[model samples]
Target: MALARQLFNRRMMWMLLGCLVVFGGIFGFKFFGRYMMNQFMDNMSLPPATVTTAPVEQQRWQTRLSAVGSMRAINGVNVTTQAQGEVKAIYFESGQFVDKGALLAELSALPETAQIEVLEAERRLAERDFKRISALYKKGVATLRELDQAQATQDQVLANLAVQRATISERSITAPFSGQLGIRQVDLGQNVAPGDPVVSLQQLHPIYVDFSLSEQDFSRVKEGQGVELTAAAIPGQNFSGRITAIDPSIDPANRTFLLQATLQNPERKLRPGMFADVAVKVEKFRSVLVVPRTAISFAPYGNAVFIVRPAKSALAESTNNKAVAPSAQAPQWIAVKRFVKTGEERGDLIEIIEGVREGEQVATSGLLKLRNEGGVIINNTSPLPENLNPTPDNS
Candidate 1:
């Protein structure tokens, strides 16, 4: 009888465990479904997000090519001495403007000058002797050989004097052309060797600016085309110039076309080795739909934009009042994603080729909170940037 009671007690414990497991499973399944349905309904009843919008308008677009370049002097060189000698005197000061053929410095050539004087005295004496010999020979008192010897001595003395003068000229260094001089490198009374640099001369007027463009634009770029340049050193000042030269052969390594432009720098504000920014007008478009560059969103798939979807006639105008406090004066708009065919970007603005029209409005600032057909309200109190050619402010 005790054995039978033990089997019955085990069966009762097993039945109670099975009942608890089944009841918990049923309750948990119902709770999960109810919670998930609540979340779905909440997302469906979400209010429209506020976003800033701008109208796409037609504007005249002038295509331009931009490049970074460097400034160079029209004529620049380092002045050097031809002959090695001790500096005797410096005729010009450092950083002085000199003319062509003006003496810059003189080397000690005293010995050569003294030798010139001695040759000149000998030449005079030989001339007098030759005259006497010729007179004597004409009267048959002197031999032909004696007269010939006298003439040769006079010619030899004159040639020696000329050679001495040329030696002195080599010792004296002069400016080759008129230009502003740099600081002198050699000191007074210092011995300098041949080919040693003395000063640097640079012609500041009409400087040249060299820049490069892609080989694809080789046909559009030509000599005499106008270009504008600006330098960071001199702010707010723009220099205008024309294309002086274009390299016929493209750079095979970089596939670029090297170009040079000439600009008049009368004040000498533009200097050699300065960094310059260059712009050349390529072509113009009569009418184009443009928007702020910030309005477009770039993605791996393609470039896209959020266009304001029109109101539906079937939906009530007061529908926005259901989710959030809505104003009757404010127009309701829905965001619709569109892939656009874009053209060149002009500074802060960009050109839209297709997928949008002139009268359509686009979301500019609030792109983070948007979906394919998300509802939104248009608020343009803070407008997007409209600068077509924006530049950084250095100051």
Candidate 2:
């Protein structure tokens, strides 16, 4: 019985030992799998990102003040009639160019023309009687009063004729100035009253552009300052002119002052009331650092840019150590994010006031995928546009 009991104990002990080995193997396998995964992840590296880059450039930039404006003719008016009468004849066609004093229309004047003939006949009769009275007065056969009466009648008749001629002249309508005419408002035989619109006349050549500027810019502007203009109606065309006039008083509501610029419209393409974009060259040219606008990464906190440089060089600079020795492999490039201070923008380029030096390469595309100190492969085959004055591409 003692031997059997001892054998049972040993069997139980062996079973327990087998159970411990199986559980230990399972736990160790799990821990080994987890350790292998962490090692693989730590050694792995992301693929280099493809990006486009542009070099920082220093150039002379003109300082300009911009504003919206409207085009106007130097002389524009709504032509109207001065006399009340029926239009007997319409001499001018719609949109015809005319000179000063050129007849535009004529009113019906038959009554006034007929009255002149009667006055002339009456004057002839008065002159004959005055001659007979004068002959009698010289022979002492007529009273002085008789001679005076004859002379008075002749003078009265002459005055009546002069009044009739003046009345006939008012029936004619003529151009007040040399300009192009708009659509005709009066038709033939249409009765028109005084102050009624006849047509519109505008002197389009050497047109004026009316714009306003802030009162703060008042001192920077003066008569004869150069201005450049562009209109959406006529795209891709630039018009140059000079400031011709400036309002002495500032607008109380907006605190802006009015300015008028004169530009020659030889093609007559610029019409009155056209909306225009005006840029006044306010200051002399000065040197400034510029970069492609796409290079900037705008954020609510601040603006930033990714500067591309040799990976070894960047790492060494960050560590404040000397550059690593050159390797046999090709040089690796990396993107380093940098905060920047920006100024006014022109076209697709923006002025960089701080953070980057001239000639340093900056990433212009693929900014979203880039990380600080990340590897980059430059592919400028499809470079972004960097025009100083960009325009729409309808094609």
Candidate 3:
């Protein structure tokens, strides 16, 4: 019995020691996990993000009505032949500038020239006969009927001569107006018919641009309103002109009115059929709150901007800690995302209608790394552009 009691006591003591070790291990693991979590939380505090910012401004913005337009020459037409004949000579080269009534081409006028010569000879003989008859009639040698007959014969010959000359003129093609000619459509020895296109001519100086605006804007627009034009074909250049004409009636099919503007093209750089963007200065300037377009974070749900301000949490911590001087430590700023109402957009700036005030600085760059209440540092060494009218670099 003594031996058994001793053995039982030994077994109980071993079991008790094993249970204490298991419980101690479980509690120790739980404490260690808690400690690790605290360390991770401390490490998760992120540093401030560097960003560029700009202050919201109040600017005088002019109202403008915009539309797409097409350019046209003041005078454009296709020069054609007036009579049918074989082309004998081409006087002008392709793409040449010619004056009005300048000869372009000449058809084979050999037959017509021969006929004119014959008619002239007949006219000369008839004139001499008429003179002789008139002289005799005055002297009473020739009768009145003979003088009248001779006079009639001379008039007939003169009429025939004029008709032959007109036929020759019809065979010669000339420029109807002063302009530049396009590619020549005919060559030497090529037969052409009447009304067939010979070449295209266009008076390029003082070009016209035709555009349309909504009928609602008809009352707001008038002749002499200033217009600014930019074309995709000619970038970085703007042409200015004034409205020259407006359609009297609106198109019933589209409810739009046509507007025409005249621009001087002394260089002839603006060509017909080129597409252009037109902006008509419609109203006087008005003051409005504006911001750089880059500052806004556009979203389908709502548009927002990050307004920078002092971080309250950091300020409180600094206040509590007397050892850390406010001046010694770098200033802390936080980006607070605020929804905004935007109005019309100009070149690089946008009108802010609501949710922001003038003189408040908003983050312009590094927006993708930003979040609400996130830490930020303002670094405006390289700021984004905010021009009202931005131009492309020639390079």
Q: TM-score of each candidate?
A: 0.67, 0.72, 0.79
Indicate the TM-score of model 2: 0.72
| Residue lDDT tens for model 3, 1-395 | 99999999999999999999999999999999999998776545566799999999999878889999999999999999888899999999898999999999899988889988898899999999999999999999999999999999999999998888888898888998898999999998998999989899999989999999999999999999999999999876788999999989999999999999999888888999999999999877888999999999999999999988887753453423423223334548978888999998878999999989899889999999997666799999889998877888768
lDDT tens string, model 1, 1-395?
99999999999999999999999899999999999888667555346778888889899866668999999998989989888889998888887889988998999998888888889889989999999999999999999999999999999998888888888998988888888899999998999998999899888888999999999999888889889888889865778999999989999999998999999999989999999999987665468898888889889888999888664531343334434323444335778778998897766788999878998889997788886566788888878678855655778
lDDT tens string, model 2, 1-395?
Answer: 99999999999999999999999999999999999998766544657799999999998988899999999998899888777889999889999999988898889988888888898889999999999999999999999999999999999999988877777777788888888999999999899998998889999999999999999999999999999998999986788999999999999999999999999998899999999999999777888999999999999999999999998677766643433333344438988889999998877899999999999999999999997777799999989998877887989
Stretch of 10 with least lDDT, candidate 1 = 313-322
How many collisions per candidate? 0, 0, 0
Worst 10 residues of 2 by lDDT: 319-328
**What shift in Å separates residue 124 of candidate 2 from its native position after superposition?**
3.5
Candidates sorted by TM-score, best first: 3, 2, 1
> What lDDT does model 1 reach?
0.84
lDDT scores of the candidates, listed in order:
0.84, 0.90, 0.89
In model 2, the runs with Cα more than 4 Å from the true position are 1-51, 126-163, 293-306, 313-331, 335-342, 365-376, 380-395
Error of 1 at 78 (Å): 1.8
Whole-structure CA lDDT of model 2: 0.90
Task: Give candidate 3's total backbone clashes.
Answer: 0
Residue pairs in collision within model 2: none
